[model samples]
Target: MAYSIINCLQAAQDGVDIICLSITPNRRPSGIATFFNPIDMALLSAVKAGIFVVQAAGNTGPSPMSMSSFSPWIFTVGATSHDRVYSNSLCLGNNVTIPGVGLAPGTYENTMFKLIHARHALNKNTTVTDDMYIGECQDASKFSQDLVQGNLLICSYSVRFVLGLSTIQQALETAMNLSAVGVVFSMDLFVTAFQLNPVPMKMPGIIIPSANDSKILLQYYNSSLQIDGDSNKIVKFGAVASIGGGLEANYNNEAPKVVYYSARGPDPEDSLPHEADIMKPNLVAPGNFIWAAWSSVATDSVEFLGENFAMMSGTSMAAPHVAGLAALIKQQFPNFSPAAIGSALSTTASLYDNNGRPIMAQRSYPSIDQNLSPATPFDMGSGFVNATAALNPGLLFDSSYDDYMSFLCGINGSTPTVLNYTGQNCWTYNSTLYGPDLNLPSITIARLNQSRVVQRIIQNIAGNETYNVGWSAPYGTSMKVSPNYFSLASGERLVLSVIFNVTNNSSAASYGRIGLYGNQGHVVNIPVAVIFKIL
Candidate 1:
C-alpha cells in the first residue's frame, strides 16, 4: 500500500493532472498513516502541489466511523444509484420474487434444482451456531459431498467483524468445490440495509437477505419441517432465476441517491487534537449499475465482469467521476489550486434532488431498521457533484494555503514548532484555528458545546452578485446568521458567522446546511455538521 501511494505521488510530482484511487486496503486500517512515514507525507505533498486527489470512501459503510480518506486535501467520493432500476427474474415456487442485481448478457435456461441446506447436512446431531454453519460453507471440506453435490446449496453468511464480501466469497467457493450448480446466499444483517454488488460469479448465484428470502426458504422447504403424520411431507422449495443483461449504457441512469453501502462520515481518522471528527464522503456519484468500459485483459472479467463493458459498483466507481470532473475543471482554470477546485465542486453541488426533496440516505445498522432520512453533510458532503455549476461557480469558499495551515493548528492545538515542518510555525504567526471555521466549502463541529459560533468567508467569483442566506436548522438547535442578506462584487469577500445554539434537547448528531443564493442565478451551499452536547 505504501509503495502504491508513493508511485501515485511520484506520478503527481511528474505532473499528472488528476489522481484517482479506486482501491482500498485489504483490511480495515486505523490511524492516518502506516507509521507516520514519509510515503504518507508524499500524499500530502502531491495534493499540496496542485494535484487533485480523488479517493474512494470504501464500500464498508452505512456504518458511522467506518469512512476512509479523511484528508481534507483529497476529494472523498461515495457511491450512489440512479433510478433506472435493473430487473432480473428470480422467483420462488410460491411465486414470490426477491430483488437481485445482475446482467449476464445472455438468457439462461431457467431450471429447478434440489435445494440443500448446509447447516442441516453438516450438524444434524449437534446444535451449532450460525458461524459454525457458515464455516461449513467457507471451508468446503466441512460439508458432505453426497448431500451438496449437484444441488443448489443454501448458505447463511454474516458480517462478523469485516465487510460482507468475504462471506460472499466463502459461500460461492463452497458451491464451486462441491460441483454444485449454484449457491443461494442468505446475507446476515449488516449496516448496509439493502445492498447489491453485481459481480460475475463462477457458475451463478444470488444473495438474499436472511430477513426476507431466508424466511421464505424456511417456510416453503419441506426438508426443514418435522414429521407430523405417518409420512414426512415436503413442500416445493425450488427457484427459477435467470441472470443476463448488464445495465445499458445511458445518460439517464438517475443518481445522487445514497447507496446503503456507500461510506458515511464523521471521519474516524482522528490523528490530531481537533481532527477527531470531520465531514467526509465529500460527494456522491452514480456508482451502482454503472456501465463502464472494461479491459479485455482483466483476469476478474471471467468471474466478476463483462466482456466489453461491465456493471461495476462501489466508491471505486464514484471517485473516478469526480476525478474526471476535476480534470475538466483544471483545464478550465489552469491556475486553480486543488483546494479551489474542491470548493467549487462543493459550493455548486445541489443538496436537493429533482423531486424537490432533500436527498434520501439509508444509514442504519445492527438492530436498527433502515430508515430513509434526508441526508445531511455527514451523509453526503455538500451533496452530489455538479460539473457544469462547478466550472463557473459564482462564489467560492476558497481555502488558501494558510487557511489549511490554520486548520492544522486547529487540529493539533499545539505550538506550530512542535512538529517542525517548513512554513508551519504556529508559534511565530497566527495559529489558533477552529475546525469548521477553516474557509472550506462545508463545516463539521466535532464537539459543539451549549453554544458555538464559527465564521466563514465567501469570495465572489462571479461579477456583482448579491446574496440571501437560506438554511436548515439542525434538530433541537436554533440557528442564527448575523447579517443574512449581503452583496459581493467581483473579487470581493464577505465574512459571516453562523451561530448554532442548543435548545431544549437530548444528545445526538445534528445535520443541516447554510445556503448562499445570489440574485444572478448563483448559489453556494455549505453543509453544517455538528455533534452537540451539553457543555
Candidate 2:
C-alpha cells in the first residue's frame, strides 16, 4: 500500500512542494540484517527529487524504540498539547461538584434542573432488557417524556457505549426528543478504567468518567428517590443538578508538552540495541484535540457524525501541522532545499513553551495523575515548533542528494539494495561516508565511545553577523567547539568541529544543546544526545 502511494508521489513530485505521509505500516525489524525499508528508500527518492517529505512518528508510544519513522531524510513529527482545553463540571443539588469533559454551552449558573435517571423514566411497556441499551437512552420511544421533561437525564456508560454499539450522539437525540434539559453519563462500575476525550454536545451535558465519582452521583440520586416498595423498584426521581459551561476554553499554562501517545525518538540503526545518529521525530506540533474539518459521512468520530468539523488527535494530525509550516517556509524561501527547510524548523524550535518553562513529556502510559518529566531530544526532537522564528532562521544546515546517498552507503547498503529502492547504483557516488556525517540540525550518537569528533557546516542565510557559540555538555561528557566565536556574511558558510570527550562511564543516555547567539538577534540551536556504554 505504501509502495503504491510512493509511486504516485514520485509521478507528481514536480508539482508537489511538500508531501505529508501521515500513515505508517507495521514496524520493520531494526538491525544490520535489513539495510533500508522500501518505503523509506522511496521517500528518499522523493527528497532527492526536490520534494520535501513530512512523516508522522507512529502512535504506539510512551515506550522506547517504538517509532516507525526512523529515516533521517524524512522530517518526522510528534504530537503535543496546545495551550487551550475545554473543561466542564457537574454541580449536584447537594452542592457537590465533579469535574468532567464536554464541549457544549452551559445552563445559567444558578439554574438548577430536576434530575432523573434513564431507567427511572423508562416506558411502562418498553421491551428492552437491562443488558441492552435501556439505561443508555438510545431509544426515545422507550423513555417517558413526562418523567424526563425539563430534567437533566442521567444515562449509563455501558459496554454498548464502549463497543461502539451505542454513542453519546444517540443518547443526545433521545434526550432532545424526550424534552430533557441536559444529560449526564454515569460511568459503569464494572468497567474498571476508561479514558474519555471531550465529546461535542449540542446541549448542556457532563460525563462523569470516574467509576467512584459515578457511584457518588448514583448514591445521591438514590437518596432523593421515592421508591414504590414493589419488586420492580420503581422510582419517583427527585435529584437536581446543573451543567457548567464547557465551550469556554481554559488556558493551559503548561502546554506544548509531548503528549503521552506521541512517538519518541532515537532512530533505530544497523546494529541491534544501537540507535542511529539521526532523531526520529524531527520536531513536535499541536496534535491533541485539534479541531479540523470532518466529512459528515465519516464514522471515525461519533460525536461529530452530522457536524462539519471534529476534534481530532494523533501524529497524523501533527504531521500536517509541520507540512503546513514547511509550505510557509517554502513560500518565503522559494529556493530553499528540503534539508534547508527542515534545518530552519529544527534550529528555530522552542525548547521552552510560552510559559517560560521547559517543555515536559508524559513519562508513563495511562497516567491518571499525568506524571511528567522534562522532555529530552528523544521525546520532542528540538521542541515545539515556532512558526515566526522558523521563517527567519539566520542559518541552515544544508545537505544535498549526494549526502543522503552517502548515508545509505555508510550503512553498507549494497548496489543491489540501493538499486532496488532508489534505482541508483552505489558505485556512481562516494560510498565511504559515515552515518554521523549527515549534517543534520540535531545530533545523536547512539553509541558514544570514549572520544569522538563530529563536524557541522552552517550557512548564514541572513545578514552578516558575529555568532558566539555556547553549549551545555551532556552528563559525564565534555564538549569543545573550536573557534567559539565567528563572523559570517549572508550566503557564506562556516565549518565547526565539535569534540566530545567522556569524563565518566555511564549506562544511560544524556542530552545537551549547542546555541549560536548572533549579534543581529538570530539564534540557532542544535540538540545533542549521547548514549554511553561501560568502558
Candidate 3:
C-alpha cells in the first residue's frame, strides 16, 4: 500500500492536479493514535506536493469512527443518493405489481411464465440437504431441468449471499442451466432486514425485499399451486409472473441524501483519548446508482462480465465527483493552492436540498424502513458539493506547506517523524501551534476545556466586497467573532479570532455555522463543531 501511494505521489509531483482514491487500504483503524500509517504518511507527502487529494470515507458505515482516511490534509468524501433511481417491478398473473431492484433486462413485456420455487423443482437424483443448495439455488444440478424449464425460478436470498458465500451470479447461472426464462429472489425470512445492493444480471431478475410484499407473492403462489391427491402430494406449478425491465433510469425531484453505507465521523482521534479537531468527509456527492466506466475484464460483477459500463454505488464513487470538480477549479484558478481549492468547495457547499430543507443522512443500516434525520458536520462535513458556487467562492481560507507541517507538529508528531515523511524538520518553525489552529474552511475543537480562542485567515479573491459576519453558536457554547463586519479588496487577507465560551459542560458534540454574507453576491459558510467537556 505504501509503495502504491508513493507511485501515486510520484504522478502528482509530475503535475497531476488532482488524485481520486476510490479504494480504502486500511479501514479498521479508528483513532488518530493509529491513523497515520505508512499509507497515510505517503498521502501526506502527496498533499505537501501541492496536489489536491480526495479519498473515499469507506463503505462500512452508519458506524461511528469507522473511517479509513484519517489525515487532516487529505479531503475525504461520503456517498449520497442524487434523486435518480432505477426501478424494477414484478407483475403477477393476478395483476399484483411489486417493486424490486436489479440491473437487468426484462422478459417479454406482460408475458407471464410459470413460477416454481427451487425446493419444489428439486431433482430426485441429488441428495444435497443444505438450504443454500436447495432453496437458495447455489447448485443448478440439484434441480430437475424438466420441472424448471420455461419457468420463473424462485430462489431464496440468504445471509450467505450477504457474507459472499452465495452469489447472484450462481443463481443466474442456475436459472440459465435449468432453461428458466427469468429469476425471482425471495428475501430471507429469518434475517428480516439487510442491505440488498443491486447486482448486474444478464437474465431477467428481481429481488423482493419487503416482508409484506414477499408474503403477498408467497400467498399468491400457494393459491395457484395444484396438488395431486395421493399419499404423497405431487405438485403442479401454476403461479406466473412477468419481470419488468429495470435498466431504465428514473429522475425525480427527490432531495439528495447521505447514503447509509457512507462512513460518518467526528473526525477520528488526535493521538490518544481526544478526538481530532478536523471535519472528515470534507463533503458529499452523487454516488448512488451512478453509471460509470467499468473494466471489461473485472470479475467484480457477473452481470457486467464483458460490458464497458456498469451501475455502482459507494463513497468510492463520491470521491471521483469531487476530484472532477477540483480539476475544474484548478483549470479556472491556475494560481490557487490546494488549500484554496479545498476552501472554495467547502465554503460554497449547500446545506439544504432542492426542497430548501436541510439535507438528511441515513442514520441506520440499509433496509426497507429508511431511518433518516438532518445531517450534521459529522454526518456531512460541510454539505453537498456545489460546483457553480465553488467556482466563484469570493473568499478562501488558504494554508501553505508550512501550515500543514505545523499542523503535524501540533498533533504531537515528532520532528524526526515529520522529517521522515515530509523531509521537513518541525524545529525550524520554533513556534507553538495546535491542530485546531490551522486555517481550515471548518473549525473543530474536539475537546474544549472551559474555552479556547481559535484564529482564521480569509482572503478576498472575487472583488472588493464588504461583508457582514453572522454566526450561530454551537450548542452548549457561546461564540463571538472579532470584527463582525469587514471589507477587503481583491487579494487582500484578514485575520479573525473566534472566542468560544462553554455555557454547558456536555460531552456530546455541538454543531453550528458562521456565515459571511457579502454585498457582491458572495456567501461563504464555515462549519463549527466542538465538544464542551469540563475538567
| Candidate number achieving the greatest lDDT relative to the actual structure | 2
TM-score of 3: 0.91
The parts of candidate 2 lying over 4 Å away from their true place are 2-14, 29-35, 126-130, 158-163, 189-197, 210-216, 219-238, 267-275, 364-370, 412-415
Error of 2 at 54 (Å): 1.1
TM-score for each candidate, following the candidate numbering: 0.75, 0.90, 0.91
> What's the count of clashing pairs in each model shown?
6, 0, 0
What are the lDDT figures for the candidates, one per model? 0.66, 0.83, 0.82
Ranking by TM-score: 3, 2, 1
Instruction: Answer with 2 or 3, whichever has the higher lDDT.
Output: 2
User: Which scores better on lDDT, 1 or 2?
Assistant: 2
Task: Estimate, for each residue in 1-535, the C-alpha lDDT of model 3 and write its tens digit.
Answer: 7676768668776888887888875444543344456766777677777788888988877766766665677888998888778888899989999988898799997588999988888888764464435788888888899999999999988777766778888899999999999899988776546455567888999998776678789999989888877744556778899999788878774668888888887543433432357777789999877888889999776556677887888998899999999999999999888888999999999999878999988877535126888888888889999999999999999888777667666556466666766677777764466657888999988888888999999999987999999999999999999879999999999998999999998767789999999999999999998877778
lDDT ranking from best candidate downward: 2, 3, 1
TM-score quality measure for candidate 1: 0.75
